[model samples]
Target: MSLAPILLFTYNRPEHTQAVLDSLSKNKEAIDSVLYIFCDGLKENSSEENKSKNKLVQQIISSENRFKEVKITIQTKNKGLARSIIDGLNTVFLEHEKLIVLEDDLILSPFFLAYMNDSLNRYKDFKNVGEIGSCNFFACGKEFPTYFFTNMPDTWGWGTWKDRWNKFNEDAVFLYKELEKNNKMHAFNTYGAYDMEGMLKDQIFGKVDSWAIRWQAVMVLNNWLCLYPNPSYSNHIESINATHAKINMVPPLQNNEPTFETIEIKELKNVTEAMQLGYSGKGDYFGKLSKKYLKKKTKKILKSVLLFPLPYGIVAFFKKNKPKK
Candidate 1:
């Protein structure tokens, strides 16, 4: 088996599982790498048949790909997403120094594997880089072929070494209370503060459950730079009412093309470059769509167009034009 395994997590959604696996099979380095499949056990409210059918998801995830780069971890009891990922990762790390992770829904480019492996090897020793990501949400504005930047961390296609994974504070013993007292919640605004460690306190206290938000918080607070592509590598798979997206912030692609990559090992400037790229693209579309009534991104720009009273503006917009009350 290869030293690094392509780690995959799957639940229900057999079709999505199959689609992502198909994409992985097409990836440039799939033949040489090992695929470590972690199939989560049956969930609550699911009938026995549904539980048994859970095998289908696993099969779809690992099916027909019995090559050098394929391994399976089937859980008998349901561990949930949080436990499964953190614990599954622990298991994977025991045998592999580095891991490339993916969920059942995510699709990747052929170069995605190549890029992630390259970054892992190049930045494995870079103290500031906690993770090497295969995805970024930035619009590839005025693409200059390739570039690098830091940003809010994503839980999509990503790779990391055992060193950084070991550094993760599972207990979150140090930073949780401090992050709250300092009013630094804004700093960890990848998706929202709901994803912040602020919300993870309950999960830690046996009140709730989650996985990724806290991990992102751990990585971000430690001053670790999460490397990202300009146009994003793996597109989100669970877009419509799937498990992950809470508010359905499925905005249209602003500048999806002209995606950026890293041509060489270079010191990153700051997270500003990626944000700048995204902002400029949206800004251009804001003006570009002002005249056209049906232009995309107009709704997004206008949704947050108001300055103060953010909640009120959003509620008012949603409540407008009643459906025959």
Candidate 2:
């Protein structure tokens, strides 16, 4: 494909969605891009949560500034996040070889799209690169703007090739069946306690779900690397409202001083090297368990002691209900 398609997943959060779109429109390069919006339908009519979905649809219709090129997909029925994403991706892959995926709550810098497309094109021949990710949450103590290596490409704002997308098991409804009964899903080692397998457990057994983590498991099984920005190419605006986010406080990293932009292709080598060392090949089981348990305990203490007076939980709840447009 001459250009990479951007796959946007949205539900009822029109304000956040609108903010995300605004960020996209202000990008340094917009005319050559294609934005494909996947507006999910309500899961069930008269459902209480459909109020947000209704507003999200209104925002999409109200947006006036058109990108260089844009295509939209509106589902008549609610397919839920996981299904809507897996299905929307399948359709996009039919037309484009590469795609950059974004959600309503994440905002990208002017160079985010450009960086992703260039990386995808540059690494198309390399099977080791499973995806392009801009969600740089950690401070790697590096001097450059970005880095890459390995990690399950979290879907906050990511890009991938059609070939890799096809490899994820989208029809994993009976995930528990495959895990305990049948034992077909592959497991990869992790240096922390939160490997793909535990993610699956959290989904099926722990009352959790997300298509991205499952896809990460598949990438891990295949032993592939996911590139990340050094200073983070994208920032999570939905941190307060995001259900899947582990850290839901006022972002310690939000600001407008340093311009976020992509650097020359010569820098990709450093990114690639760091990513490779980020994960263990065997799904570091003990580390995964340790990280998860420790983080859980820490969050509990933070909520009860350090962050007690602020009504953080209430604020987060309202944010969750806030419009995405």
Which candidate has the highest TM-score of all?
1
Model 2 whole-model lDDT (C-alpha atoms): 0.64
lDDT of 2 at 150: 52
- Per-residue error (Å), model 2, residue 74: 1.7
TM-score of 1: 0.73
- Determine which window of 10 residues in candidate 1 has minimal summed lDDT: 283-292
TM-score of each: 0.73, 0.70
Clashing pairs in 1: 34-69, 35-69
lDDT of 2 at 239: 52
162-278 per-residue lDDT for model 2 (tens digits): 888878874444444444353434334333424556667676654665887678666665567777655555778845557566553121232233433433323244333333333
Candidate 1, residue 117: lDDT: 75
Compute the lDDT of residue 243 as modeled in candidate 1: 74
TM-score of 2: 0.70
